[model samples]
Every structure is written in C-alpha cells, then in structure tokens.
Target: MRLAHAHSVQQSGAYVRKFGAAALLLALCSSVGVIATSGTPATAAGDATSASRARTDELTLRTGQTLAKVKASIPSGSYAGAYVDPSSGTLRVLVTQQAKAPALDTRADAPLELVKARYSLAYLEQRMGEVFAAREKLNGKNSRIVSVDVDEAANSLQVAVDGPIDAALRGRITRLAPDTPLELVQGNSFAPQRYAGSRVDDFAPWSAGVFIYNKTTGGGCSSGPGVHVGSTKYMVTAAHCATATGQQFYQGHQDVPSVTPELVGTVANRSGYPNLDAMLVNGNTANTVYRSWYNFYTASSAPWESLTGQTVCTGGAYSGERCGLVIGQTNVCSDSLRSCGLTIATGPVNTVAAGEGDSGGPVYITAPGLRYSGIVTGPVNPANSITCLNYPSGLRSCSNAIVFTRIQNILAYFGASLN
Candidate 1:
C-alpha cells in the first residue's frame, strides 16, 4: 500500500494484442538463478569477474596519447583497473581480480573507453550521496529508536521502534531523512516479512501463463506473477489486464497463454470488472476445477483504519508474491473523484514493482497455510512519489509505507467468497 517508488514511464493506456515474444524468449533462454549475495558463491566462473571488473573493454588510439587520456575514454566505473597495450594500440580494461584473469579480446570496432568511465563515476557518486544523507538524518532522531540497519542493495534504511508513535513523529522522521528507505518495525521481536517463492501449480484452475484476450482493446494478456483465484480454470487480474488497456501481466518471463475468454454465459456472468481499471476472467469448464486454497480476503472493511503497528501483504503483478508491513492509509475524496481508499505496504520495491500492468493483482496477507488476504484496487494518490508531505495536514504520506486498495469491498461487489 505504500508508494515506495513511482514509475518513471508515463502510463500509455495503449493495449497491444501481440504477446512479447522477445521477452518470453529471453526468460526461456536464461537460466533461473537466485541473486547471489555478497558472501554467496559465484554462480558462474565469469560471475565473480564481472562483478568486480570495470565495464570499459577496448579503447583505440591514433598517436601521441597518454595512458590516462586513453583511460579517460572509458567510463570511470567501467573497470576496476586498466592498462595500455602499446603493441596492439589498444587499452585493456581489467574488470575483476580473480585467480585466473578474464579474456579481453579487443577488436578494431571497440567503443571509446572514456565514455563508460565518466558515466559510471558520476552514477556511483550520486548513489553514495543519497546513502550518506539518509544516514545523517537517522542519527539525529530523538525517539526511543530501536535499531537501524542499512540494506546495501536497496540503498535504504530499516528502523525498528518500541511501539506505536503519533503521526507527528512519523512525519518528522521521514522529513529528516527523505532519501532513506525508512521502515518502522513494531515490537522488538517482529521483523518484516521477507519474500519466499511460490509454486505456479498450487494455484490451480488458473495456470500462471494463461492469457485473456480483451475485446475492448483487442489485445491478449496474462496475469502477473501472483496467486490467481476462481474455479481452478478461472483467474483474476486488473481490469486493465483483462481489457488489455496498455496493461499486460507477466509470469516469470513468459506471457500467459492467450485464450478467447468465455464472455457471455458462465464466463460473462462470473467474470467481474468493477470499474474502468479492474477485471476478472473465468476459466471454469467441465474439466478445469477451481482451487479454494488459492483465494484470500482482506482484514478490514471499506474506509479502512490506519492503525499503527498493523502488518499486511499484497500478492500482485508488480510486487510479485512478496509481503510487507503497512505504515499508512488515507481516504481520498473529491468532487470529481469519490472516496478512493489507499493503504501503503513497504519492503524492497522492484521494477515490475507495481505499474499499470499490476492493476487487479491480489493484495493479501497470509499466516503460513491459514487465511489468505485479498486483491488491491489501485495505488495511492500523488500516485508515484515514494515520500510526499501532505500540505494541509503537514504529515508525510507513506514515507515508509506503500499504498493499496481495500479488498473486502471488491470481493463483496463481485459476490465472490474467500477463505
């Protein structure tokens, strides 16, 4: 429910029918590998080398050029180090230092090394500044602060607190350290939930790669990587996904297989799209069966309460199958727009992180194998910014939380049952 990070690209709303063959092929060809943390084994021999190596590879020189000048041709961060091969008229870039050196075959058409060096150096400096600023603000906090841990990969800070604090305290902490990934962990014992993978087959009836063709926009689309609900055959996704309005979902790397969605009879009656951005696809047939185990519900009713220390998770196209803790909720109503409630959940935000493609994805909480939560309606207003100050209230809107839609209302509107 938290607005962790905004999508840099604007929403096009352009729905295309063709499946992304290129993306699907890339996923199929690439090996499925877990991210190797700093201490983990290098998955491949080149892995370690690539990690430490400078990116600059080949640089060419006509005449009368010093090694530093040639090195400047490559980007600053391209390689950890470099050397000039005077005989070959090439500048060799060393990427990593391993027991065995990597092969650097320079060809005539190699690019200028300086370009890479300059860009990488600038990028590294910018990121370091952000990290340093976040740390300084956290150090000045006066509350009963518990512990502060830095997520190096995410470049954010996770702060644990003793108990619930007022909205004022939350705002101050966020304002003091705007760039840091500030997460408020409740009791000393409770740690935020980390992402554990899910099985595609367990959510039966709705196969992970099943695609639905949208007549509205004439496009084929699939559900993003999340639990799909309904009679095993039928699945649910954002109405945008079902409608294919520039919103397409992905499972791993492959696009969900497309089928002419059964629209009129059982399909039309059961399939639900509450508004312009929501949709449900029915896959129930004679042979296909729905699995109750896959579905879930929300904890609160419509117009939810922003209770501090409350925990929640959302299973959707972007956040994929991850869960996090909720830090803020707000009721937004206006003349043109009705009261659209928003809840913010936070953790490590990713790319398919949550975008137009993730609409209609389920946002639910699970206690191991027990009760499952429900689907998210939409993201919070002031849409994409991770941290924003509410002008009138002077409170920070989810500086530490992500926003989400209330699920119970959506479920009730569709007349669907959840366990």
Candidate 2:
C-alpha cells in the first residue's frame, strides 16, 4: 500500500500484494517524525482508565502464572482452555468436567476460577486440523472464509468469513468434526501489512524494533528480537520483508535524501505465506529490543508464550509504542487459508495497535520488564478499520486488531534460541 497524507501525518505504507482472497504480506517503509531517544516514557499513565489497566496487567500476569502452574499439575486431556475475564479481571480456567479439576492450592490472595467446558483444548485443536484438511471445500472461487481458530472462551472452533456460507458447505465442515462446536462468524477478514520506509542511525550491536530497509526493494520494516543459531547471532524479521535469501537489509529508512544507510544484515533463511512468517538475518545482533523508541533488555532466556486474553504491546517504526492490546484469538489462519498459526490482538476501538511499517517489529509484554511475545504480521479486517493512525504524514488503513506469529514458533523454525 502506498503512503498518502492524512491527519497531518504521512501514513506509513505496506507494499500491497494479493494472494487468492487475502492480501499477501507487504514490504515495509515509513518515515516517522522525531521521537524520544532518552528517558523512560509514560506507560499510558495519568488517567483513571490507564491506571486501572496498569493494575489489571499486574493481576493478569500474576493470575497467568497461577494458571500455568495449574495446567502443569493437571492432565492435558482434562483441560480445555484459559482466559482472564475481561470485565471482572479474574482468571478463568476451563476444564472438560468440574470433577476433573485438581485440588486448589491458592493463597487466598490469587484465586483461579474453574469453569466446566464442553471440549478440551486438544479436542478443539484436533478439530482445527480436520477443518484445515477440508479448506479447499470450505474456501472456493469466491472464498469467503477468512480465518479458522479455536475460541477458548466459547469452547469451540470459530470460522471467520467475510460473507454468508451456504448450507452445503456448512454441512461439509460440520462433518469434518461432528462433535466439535463450530461457530460461523461474518464480517471478518485479515490482510498482510508489512511496512516500508524507515528509521535512522541504527548502529552496530543491532537491537530489534529498529528500522531496516531492504536494499533490493527499498522498502523497510521494524526488526524483531535478536536470536542465536549455535554461536552466530542473527536478526529476526517478517519473511515478507524480502522475497528471497541473500538480500541485504540496511539500517534506517530509504528516503534519507542522498545518504546511503549502513548495512544491517543479509537474509540467511525465510519462512513465509503458507507457513510461519519469519526470516533470519545474519548480523551483529544484541538481546535488546525497542519498547517505545529506546531499547530495553529482553529476557532472552524466558521468551513469552502467548495466551488468550493476555495483554501485549508493540513498538513499530512508524506507530511507535502501543500497548493495552489484548490477545483475541490464537493459532489463527489468514483469509488466504495458507497463512496459519498466527495470533490476533485487538486494541481499544479506533486505536492503532500496529500499522504499516510495523511488521517484523517486536510484540512484547512489559509488566516485569520487556519479554518477547511475537512478531507483528498484519491487521485483521484490514479493508475496514474504525480509524487510521497517521505515520509522519499519510493515509493508510489501520485496524484496532493486529496479527502476529509467536516467538517460540519462529525460534523453533530457525533452530535458534533467543539471543
């Protein structure tokens, strides 16, 4: 997508490409205005709502820790899924049956509410596989299916589509997993939104979340956390940033007048489209990643595993630091049905969780310091957004929701660990 001027800011651009019914991941490059380079920025404080959210984040983390322990103590087959109640700010654990729940050992300070579920997470996951097997029958020439994911709260598999599904196709999907609860949702579609343009002066000992321009395409995107494959360090980015291996990426934006930017790295490997959207760049990388504008030390040894209803943040090159984004769906597929295993997060209405030029940026949590969560992939229902957040100066479609690939999946794919 080309950047157009809007709201006195240059809208960042995500190089648009189409694949079937969905937009393929785009090359990124966005020129952002001057940003803070020093001091601790506000974590969206100074208001009642922000203050409430801060408390909720702390509670969510604490409850999440408890939930982890609870799951570890129980049989996998007995558990369904878990989520933090959005309204009450309480942890809710789902079990196949109330009788399957283990003896509670809470300190009275933090209590986990167990809810009986109709199906286990494993059951829903198995059904998801079966549904994917019948993608061709469900997604046809006019492809209406946007995404398929397990809705933990609903204890069912949700199939998101842009329009109505005929009775025959519904029956076909139902037959794939008759016992599994299937939910058909309308008016939902996702598109790839890798960004183009850039940042300046991203020096050596490179950190993630800084801008890097593709020398071949002249498009740029924010970087992800650094990782190590054996003894060598490499940078992580969205695979859509470069079409092939060996392409060089430069530090800073491409539109920096007549100046040539510094070299960041070369694409060593890439996994895209139908698989996890990530790429490895052989470079001098550090364990630090950008939170807002400044770099923060990442807990490389403890990369975060995403959970439904968990809060998240992103530091896009163009969108800067945005937080209070809640995970809405996990292990989801895009509208194309090829891009699968992505996580989706939604921000406040009309707010930007991430925008073009944000792809490949770090999606992390920041309660007890920054922890890597995933890499920004794109926007959900990209065609229609409540509002667009300007990038320096331009018009671009931005949704309150974002799509990302988990960090564990990326590391596993590259046979690397967090740096």
Candidate 3:
C-alpha cells in the first residue's frame, strides 16, 4: 500500500495542545538552473543608473540566459560575481579584469552592465574561509557571529553578527584577510522553520508538500519532492527532521488515542549543516508536489541553480502557496558553522514568505513547467521586525526573508534525481 499525507488545517488549537508551540519551533531543527555561453569582451556598459529598464516578466528569462553567457565567457579566477538589478532589470557582472567581460548585445528584453571588481570570486571565497578560521580561534561558545558570505555586489566578505564586535577581536579577524576588506553587518539570529503539507491526509505513492512527523525525533515538518536513488524511491526533507538513518517517518501529525498516524518511510540517508541540510526518506513516493490543496504540480527532474533577483514561489503546508518572493542573495553561508552555497529570498517587508512548519517545503518556479529550485531551511530575522501574518496559533512566526538550500546541491550530494 502506498502511504500518503494527512490533511492539515489552519486551526492550531489541537496542534498546540499536543505539541507546544515553542517545542515545535525548537524541535523544528529536524524539520527542515542553466543557460547559455558567450565569449568575447564586449564593451562595458554604462553605470547602473543609466541602464535601460525592462519589465520583470520579460527580463526574468533573458536575465538567466545573459548571466549564463557572462559566466561562461569569464575565467573563474577573474569572475567576481553577477546578478540582475531588480530596479533596472539590468544584468550586472563583476569581474576582476574588465577586459574579460562577456560581449553581450543588449536585447530589448534586458540590459547588461559590467562593473570592475577589486577581487575575484575565488579570492573572496578564500578570504571568507580564512575569516571563519580566525573566528574559531577567537570565539568559542556563545559566539555573536550570525552568518558569513561573499557580498558579490560589494566585492567584500560580509560577516553578520548579532552584537557589536570589540575592536581587538575585529582587528584579529581583519588581519587574517588583510588583502580583502570585511563588511561587518548586523542581523538577528536565524532560526530553522519547520512544517508544510496540503491535502492534510492521503495514502502510499505520497506526493511532496505534505505534513510529516518524525516518529523517532517526535518532530513535525514538511516533505520535499520525491527522489530516486537507484531503484529505491525516497522522499526528500530537511536533515534536521531526523538526524540518523533508520528513523521512521509518518504522514500525519502525531495524534491522540482516537487517531493513528500512517507510516510513510524510513531515513535512507541524511546530510546536515556545513553540508546540504537534506535527507532522503525511502518510501513509495512520486514526483508530484502540491501547489494548492487540490492543485498538483509536476516536480522538474532537472534542478535549476538559483540567481539573485529571480522571482520565485514557495509551497508550505501551513502557508499553502505564497509567491512574489525575490531572490536576494545566492551562495550565502548562515553563521560560521553552516555550509555555504545557501540562498536567501525575501518578499515585501509586511508579507510572510514561509511560516513555522513550512520547512522542507518546495521552493520552485511554475513557468514553462514547475521547475524545482530549492527547499526551505528557515527564516532570517530582519533587523527590524516584520508583521507576522495570520497562521495557526502556534505557528504564527513569519518573516519577509527566508534561507533555503539549493536543490542542485541537495541532489548532487545525494547522487539522486528528483522522482
């Protein structure tokens, strides 16, 4: 018999009774692209202010292709970073050597801009590592460091911390990467969000975007797209949901005596922080995932890489379907202990991207087909708090920004294909 997801509701009174709100959030530790090539140094475009503007709808596809071409033309050693300017719809490339910029003829679709950067991407990444090493020597437990990643636009290393760093400690870190400047920015502590699923309940041949409870860990979160490892079918989710192999998963929330949860699968493999925070649940699974309760979307077999300024949507059990989120940064590392290559997306300040119990849900694009992009890791608290939207009582935590693991990395690490 194929196992499926149980119907989940917005009413949280019962959910809160069974599992405390804070416990669910805390237990959540468990819950959870491509294009062209161009060569030739084209004449550098004017500054960002003078670039032509194109409609976002028209520029999204062209921007992806143009960025690909630019990447292909430049040597990795010379490539600093690149992204689409949200306001201008201009493709911007940062290169250590302006002479190596791709010769892109701007289409009516989108404009292209090339900027000279002081350092190469490789150098920034190396310096980021050095900073992390230096941090370890200076900070032990209770460190204030929140995240560390390359700010491609700034051509510097962004070191996010919750509190101010003393001059002595700052000097020590700065000395480690004397050649690269450090951008010490302030941010709130990021918390991993967990939960999502539609059709509150369903049977074997389970689809993605469903509520899942890890029986071993007693934690609940959402299921990601299904995947295939050899002949075995497995469901993908956040590794924090169940840390070890052989852990059992259920399709429904933990119920009282009147109800029984369905056994969905067992942990076949898992990867955690400092790596892709994902896991494979061996089960009778399908490639289908929910966009809405009654609407099912096909999960693209090919995982697409993320790009900044791209508009994407998220599917979570609690939040259902939320769109209009823009990719803010790619190749981000959350805190000193987490893996790099993570992406951060943000919506309007007052809007909610994904709420509690939304972790491990599908982050995707629906154009052409449902293209898989990534999975929700959690929310990054903004310096200024955003209004939380209405959700289940215990799951009201929301944010304009979220951190996610890129699907390409998750699949590559597992050597599996989206089912």
By TM-score, the best candidate is 2
TM-score of 2: 0.55
Score every model by TM-score: 0.34, 0.55, 0.54
Worst 10 residues of 2 by lDDT: 33-42
Candidate 2: misplaced stretches above 4 Å?
1-14, 18-199, 258-260, 271-273, 335-337, 386-392
Provide the RMSD of all predictions against the true structure, rounded to 1 decimal.
22.6, 20.4, 20.9
Tens-digit lDDT track of model 2 for 1-419 = 11111111222222433111234332222111111112111111222234333342234234545666678777658888877664575678888765444454454224678888888998897887668666667764555655566788899997755566767667878877797788876633333222322234566678777777677766667788889989999989877676668999887765545445789879987643334567898899877665545444433334666778889988777777788999976655343322445677888888888766677888887633356888887676555443454444444555677778778667655667887
Instruction: Show the lowest summed lDDT stretch of 10 residues, model 3.
Output: 23-32
lDDT tens per residue, model 3, 1-419: 00111223423432222212211111112101211112111112121112121221133336555766777887667888876565665678898875554666555224777799899988887887667656557542454654566778888887766566667656766777787778876644432222243345745678777778777556567888888878888888876565467999887665433335689889877643324466788899876777777556555564666678987888876677788899976655443213334577888877878765677788887642366788877665423324443333332555667777778667655667887
Order of candidates by lDDT, top first? 2, 3, 1
Model 1 per-residue lDDT at 191: 28
Expressed as tens digits, the lDDT of each residue in 28-85 for candidate 1 is 1111111111111101223212311111112111111233344444433453333334
